[model samples]
Target: MTSDLFDLTGKVAIVTGSSRGIGFAMAQALAEHGAKVVISSRKEDACTEAAKQICDAGGEAIGIPCNIVENDDLDNLVQKTKDAFGKVDILVCNAGISPFFGPATELPDDKFDLIMRANVRANIHLAKLVIPEMKERKDGVIIIISSVAVKKGNNTTAYSISKAAVDQLVRNLAVENSPDNIRVNAIAPGLIKTHFSRVLWENEEALNKRLSKVPMRRIGEPEDIAGVAVMLASKAGNWITGQTFFVDGGDTIDI
Candidate 1:
């Protein structure tokens, strides 16, 4: 009875890039808490496997492959999820990319464009597409998985810039839709043990260096971020909107 506040018994959620990593963990968590989850990513095989894992665990889930950069794919994702679940109560924009590594001055135009497209433009596209339905229902939640890289300095210049843009996007969307009962927010995770962040946590020297600054003395895991996603999407976070959660293990504070 005490846990009922977080119950998502009748909610449906769409999590992009949910085949693995933080996205997969959040999808699984949401499903476990009673939301019908739509697991999507660029790879059909991976999406299928992720959905199976959740189902095998007795959670409601389905796989829908999508490449977020493509508008057609985003359209299909929304349509498929709505067909399968009737309505989307939650949207997790977790798909992101950082295709280049260099100083900001040395960054190439193509790489910058790619980063913006994947991290910023794609989110805007998905939100706009989903907003109409959310508006109709007079209820919705959008969680954009931004990064702590935007707060502290990261070697990936374009990536950080893209994330910063996402933060602003959250603010603008939330303000615009708050009156309609839609809540928009961002989660900034730091050095989580995901494939996307392997370069920072896999190497011994790099791992130790990162850990040294974190007050927790350990790197974050996907589940750490997943818990917050559940809150922000469920009744537990009903009053919260236009906020960015820093799930970093003190990385942002130490910096």
Candidate 2:
């Protein structure tokens, strides 16, 4: 028999930015756990391709292209999911951008705005759109994919700040939604080796510098964060909310 704590059968999940990387990994993990998932990204072709892969693996999935920065796109995404799957039991706000790279003082205004809009504002928009249904049913889970940079205070100032905002967003939503039985939390991941962060792990000097700081002595994998997403979406994490769980291979704890 399936354990009640982690059983996700019959659940419907909408995972944004899931065409590739960590977002795709989380969507796949949720599907494997029996949740009918909506795989979404900006590109329609990529979303369809990811959905096909999940279906081939014997998981129920659908593709929905959404650019999170647009309100109409996000609304359409939610509408499409509801229209296709009936209801959404889980919402993974994983679509984020980190275009700016440099010291805080050197950061450009446009890049800063883009990071905030994509990472912080987009997350808030999606959560607002999903929470009404979750509240009415008194059942739902919202998982935000944050970054360990908030804890370690990396030189990626704009990115770190945006993630920190997301962390606080989780806490705020969790506190407000607890009475409705809707849970919200965040996963702060360390240097995961994904296309989004290729600049860090692909560079020899940068990779070595980052590796030396981690107790695990190596970068993380996309699957590393995927497992945590599953746990949070499952009943195993029902009592957990309003917190940021760091999945950084002890990187934050190491001296």
Candidate 3:
């Protein structure tokens, strides 16, 4: 029975932005652990392909395209997941955007608002949609993918600010939902070798500069964050709540 602690049999999970990168990895990991997974992103083809990959690997999965910035899409995503799988036991708010990579002061008002809406507000909306069912069931897990950028001031200020808000959102939600046995947490990952992060990691000069701050001396892979999500979603993390786990290869701790 002890071995069953990480098992997620009969659980249903929805992972946003799961077409690729960290979101896809988390969805795959959850599915491998016996949870039925919904692979969702803005692109239907990408979502379908990602879900098919999981299914090909013998995991139960479905593709549901969702644009997280849209309230209607978020509602439909939750409703469709429930319609297909019965109930959502796990929610991974991994979809986010950082359209502007400039100084905070120079960030356009529109871009700043977009970053906040997509990176911060979207997660809050999704959580609101799923928490009621979680309360009714008296069990649920919400994992938002934050960023290590929040730890330092950089050109990516708008994005960093958005993630900071997300970190607080996790804490606040955890405090509010702890009484209902619901857990809300976040994962703040450092520079990873994902398409979304290619700009940071692909340039040898910039990559080396960033690596210097990471004690691990290397970039992370999507799988690096997936394991943590598994732990947080399963019984292994039942006692843990309202925390942000940094999977940045020691980048956050280094000077």
Candidate 4:
């Protein structure tokens, strides 16, 4: 049963910031493959709507609002998921913030701190919440959504640095948790057409400049990253761990 390799029946997954964009796509795909998914974001209304859409499509899903920057909210998300599904088998730290875009030298201290907290520290906290149970069960998957921004120096210094930090975090966590059969990995996307990336792709000149570097000659859709996430969360990727996959349409090849 080749298809069985990717079947996620009985799996429980929590996807942060899943109200829309890449996170929503991944959550929908995971549920379609038989995983019970939790759709989370800062807004309760948005989360509820997204979750309802999945349910209307015949998938098991629920929405739980969470602000990644808040430790208490992170705790509640994990706890609520357990109350709903008993255990967590997959966690996607897809929520991130890039509120600042400027030269590294000119980045304000407050903005830099906010980026690190939301993109880096918050992920660590969420992972810690699920890991103890994962270690006990001897099976788990953690996928952090990174960005191609880490591959080169860019104006978005704080955001890029935060993603690079998570890249290393994936490797370190993979090594530490491998003994427990837990897999940790990252997916770094490039020039994706999402709300978070509207600033880059919405502008004609900026889009052209970015497309020129992308061998694929087009920007990525949220679904482009969703499939990779499914692979990482299922038995299809059972033997894989500690690697950062570049899903950037060959943009990094030239960089």
- The better-scoring model by lDDT among 1 and 4 is 4
- lDDT by residue (1-255, candidate 3, tens digit) is 679888999999999999999999999999999999999999999999999999999999999999998999999999999899999999999999988987666889999999899999999999999999899999999999999988887898888999999899999999999899999999999888999988887789988987887899999999999999999999999999999999989999957
Better of 1 and 2 by TM-score: 1
Q: Write the per-residue lDDT of candidate 4 for residues 1-255, one digit (tens) a residue.
A: 676988999999999999999999999999999999999999999999999999999999999999999999999999999999999999999999999887788999999999999999999999899999999999999999899999888899999999999999999999999889999999999888899988888889889987998899999999999999999999999999999999989999974
Q: Estimate each model's TM-score.
A: 0.97, 0.97, 0.98, 0.98
> What TM-score does candidate 4 get on C-alpha atoms?
0.98
Off by over 4 Å in 1: none
Counting clashing residue pairs in each candidate, in order, gives 0, 1, 0, 0
Worst 10 residues of 4 by lDDT: 1-10
Model 3 lDDT, full chain set = 0.94
Tens digit of lDDT per residue, candidate 1, span 150-236?
887768999999999999999999999999999999999988998888877779998998798888989988899999999999889
Global lDDT scores for all candidate models: 0.92, 0.92, 0.94, 0.95
- TM-score rank, highest first? 4, 3, 1, 2
Decoy 3 TM-score against native:
0.98
Q: lDDT: which is higher, 2 or 4? A: 4
Per-residue alpha-carbon lDDT of model 2 for 148-184, expressed as tens digits? 8897756788889999999999999999997899999
Better of 1 and 3 by TM-score: 3
lDDT score, residue 45, model 1? Answer: 93
Candidate 2: misplaced stretches above 4 Å? none
Q: Which candidate is the best by lDDT?
A: 4
